[model samples]
Target: MSMNLIEKDRVATINPLKTCQPLGAMWAVTGISRAVPLVHGSQGCSAFVRYCLSRHFREPSEIAVTSLHEDAAVFGGRKNLVEGIQNVAIRLKPDFIGVITTCSSEIIGDDVIGFIKTAKGELKEKIGEEAVEKIKIIPISTPSFVETHLKGYDNTIKALADYVAEPSQPNEKINIIPGMVNPGDIREIKHMLRLMDIESIVLADISDPFDAPLRPSTTEYKPYYPKGGTTVDEIVDSANSVGTISLTKYAGSGALSLEKKYNVPAELGPIPIGVRNTDQFLRNLKKLTGQDIPDSILDERGLLIDSMADVASRYLFDKTVAIYGDPEITSGIARFVGELGMEPKLVLTGSKSQEFVKDIEKVAKETGAEIDTMIDQDLRSMEVYLKDNPVDLMIGGSDARLMAKENDIPLVRVGYPVYDRVGYHRRPIVGYNGGIQLMDLITNTVLEKYYEPEHWKLQQ
Candidate 1:
């Protein structure tokens, strides 16, 4: 955990691994039922978001942009903002229109709150009473220059808590707050809850909506956003749950806030990437619900244990690795690999937070695996660390491909913005089953490196 090796960020960023905040806000918007995500800034910015989402999720995206021009940037984008709101409302008839501001709008001093308040009245006049009555425009001020996309995701979730959660009789159900996870990871969480016979509200769940089958099921597109999402009704129901289990602090900061305001007890856990973390995750749930750990679930746990024992000596024991990705998952992987008797030599993440380092440090101590960590870092910095402290394997998203190539190491894709690979949105990397899936990938990747065809010398 040394910062002395590389100098802090100065002028230029070489191959930045993270996107701007508005894109994350757009991703968050897709989690709401019948909600249209509208960006109040340059159309290109929104287009890039759409492109990235569409490419990563392999689904059609309907992110609307304000298309700010030179004149609008110079003077103001107030008119464009109003017009864009009216246009999206009329065209999509969305039950809720999520508006996120870009750098352009933020720089030009466009008053999003004032513009939307005025637009609300005009909507009632232009559209029928019934239409405007149900419509809601939520403005998320996400300026790209100030924070990373992960922050945008967290802020938007906080906004949902502020705008939607309400008080009611506390129910047996629970709230699950997931941060910066792909669809497959989310589905695994839902699957685990179902296995425990626990009903949970998964905020910002994109599992079904983002990865719906493309076999032509719907007649036409309505304000019904997509095939699946956490509804406004569900968001309200979160307030009445017995407690909230935030999967990651990045996106689940809202859940903590809900606990503070609504008095719902909250438990914080990192992303359940491996044996130790997943055990903690389910044990917490079992404690909350007071449900018996079903035999079926126990059997799955046994299988994971058996597999870990099999691989410890043969493939994973004493192996050295490097990992970089979202903070929660990066730490989870370190914990998991540590359990497998592997040394996570270098742990890195582009996001900034002191808490991230502390969590990984605990894993380092547990495994007796000495580690160095970097937060608020870039791929360029990761390259420097790799040069100083080389490892056998590298794990991260597509952006780390160059780092892998430079070091001549196999890179296992994980985390956000996995552009080079397909079906990342559908790959489950959490829970007991997810542990098996991950072990298969890593163990085989190591075996593939060790396999020597020349040594086998098959008969010709």
Candidate 2:
């Protein structure tokens, strides 16, 4: 049997592992309060992002676009961008505007920053100095050719940090960068921090806004700007934080850059997915804040350990798994699996970054697990590897789940684009409590397959 089942042609035929860049920028901006994201390119890009987010979050995701036409594409999009910014300003009156560059705009080398500067000038003229001063314009360049959605999210956060944070005297607050997690995960992280008596500012928090309960017909569905996101005031005061903690190393150089620029100390850690990772996260938090772990956290930790002990002998040892997603998420899950005495046989990410590869290597070496790591890898290549060398289970985003299903493999869904399952916007996979939930999901899925009736089993 050959482990090269996926041929070059088949691999070419598979859809890409990563989505378009503008969608990433859109996702980031949606977390902001009363903020409008304007894509500086074609209409389809904006429509696609809105549709995708609406489907996943089960809410209307509002965004604007330049509506690039043949004329704009041929000459320049300056006029369209200026008009689009003005229109959003006049209509939505958002507190801030997040401008994202699309593939077409990047290809044409559109002067997005210049357009924003020009729009700011016009806004000042139209709304007078006082009103214009209150509004903030954040311009993010997301060239699809250069990076994936993961990179886009990191870059946008860095841009936000640069735009709002100023140097200040260090204080007791902590800056928390939770990378691309669900709203529920964000809320849980904040809850855990509060319980530890630690104050933190979580950038782009969207829990309440995105995960609100359904209401009756008479009630109105207001846009989720008034309740979500890190406030502008909070962002301006971030330089005063005593230290910065990033949930995922893949949050990019932005977090570290903020630390250096503001003279704030920094700690890079994995996403708190399972017991081991969550424990490490709590320990780091305690070290940074110089506070003991709270009793509530201890209880949660105890419960997680108890649950793990119950299932460890049967499911934890000598199992093999495959994982693919955003680079940092893949690394975090891979480490968690290894800590449980399982083999992360293959780890893949569509993103091409040195930091991603380095993080994976570091984690794999520490866990003594053999890893086949791939950067900028596509789904086709992953499918090939799966055919060549099968694993006990797979963990990934929606695209990987489809591939897993096609291969008749049981998949534990995590990460972005979890379209097959409901409540993706509220899926919690961080903190001690989150770890237990994730482990339960993984163990139950594995056991369900293992305990299938003999008659129902396939006869090859």
Candidate 3:
């Protein structure tokens, strides 16, 4: 830790973890079956977004752009928006089109809603009025200045619910609205629900789309769309569900709306990153469904407990760790660190709210962790904190590699933008099995600290 590290301005952001809301919108759209994530802005904005998503998920981004230029920025992007919609409809014929705004569109005061209406008319003129039934365009304003990417995801999902969902006969189903976890985490949640024999609709399910397998050469190729995600009918039927289980508060806004409108009970829980949180999630499911906790799951929990007592508890106990990421994941990691009998010296996130901070503080207190937090903060603040307070381990995204190397400490990579590693999308980080896997990472990373390169040379 460098003692010369200076305090940064509170409002200034250096190497921010949270990007604009448009990315969030794009992520949400990716979960809708055959839905195209369209950006009503400059071509460059969409390019950056596509690159970012592709790099992180290791899959095609498949986002569409209106190609708004100088003229479109000044006089509004209605013409470009219409053309973009038409092109997508003709080229891809997506079941749904989710549109998000850029800073340029927001600055020029482009009415995305009006443009959508125009798009409706244009599609009618080009391919007959019945074409509206073939492709639905759902637009939500997501100017980058107002909120972080999480909001964009939440708002777009909420807007999508409003746009397509219709009340129907009660289906006695459960809706699992998970937060910004990877596709693997989402799949684990679904698997658990199936084991419990609970019918569930994972709103905006990205499990298959983001981590899609390489198709065979003879397989048919779908243009600008992936063969995964919750279908349109599933969205409508979610209204008829008996209850809703939101995995994280960050991603619960859309689920909350569904609960209110449909008179369904909503249980907001943690992201299930560790033992305690995963237990809470299963308990919530049990309460809602009145199903016996499967013996297999219980046995899996016992395995987690056995491993913690034998292996992780020995090597990682009393270890000091620094964690930083999104709001929900960081808080979950903090609690998990405590579960391993480790002290989390600093737990921070880029996206913060009073509600979120309070939640983190509560989790920290319950876990008996004395943690310093940076809410709505950046990497620089975290660096300053790390400089002043050294820790044995750092757990976060690839960005934390610099601080870990500088401090001569090991880093356990997790959360978003894990660009330096592979199979991140498929790694389990939820449920009891996921808890075991997470422990595996922690104990392995901690044990690696004792590995001396000098000893390796003597093996010959």
Ranking by TM-score: 3, 1, 2
The reply for model 2, stretches above 4 Å from the true place, is 1-13, 168-171, 214-226, 453-460
Model 2 clash count equals 1
lDDT of each: 0.82, 0.77, 0.81
Which tens-of-lDDT digit does each residue in 276-353 have in candidate 3?
888888888888878878998888889988988876556787799888888888888888888888887777777766
Clashes in candidate 1: how many? 2
Write one digit per residue (lDDT tens) for candidate 1, span 235-354: 877888888888886667788878888987888887788888888888889877887788888888899999999877767788898888888888898888888888888888777777
lDDT against true structure, model 1? 0.82
Report the C-alpha lDDT of model 2 over 284-322, residue by residue, as the tens digit.
888878989978999988888888777756666767888
Please state every model's RMSD to the true fold in angstroms: 2.7, 4.1, 3.6
List candidate 3 stretches off by more than 4 Å: 1-8, 217-223, 451-460
**Ordering by lDDT:** 1, 3, 2
Clashing pairs in 3: none
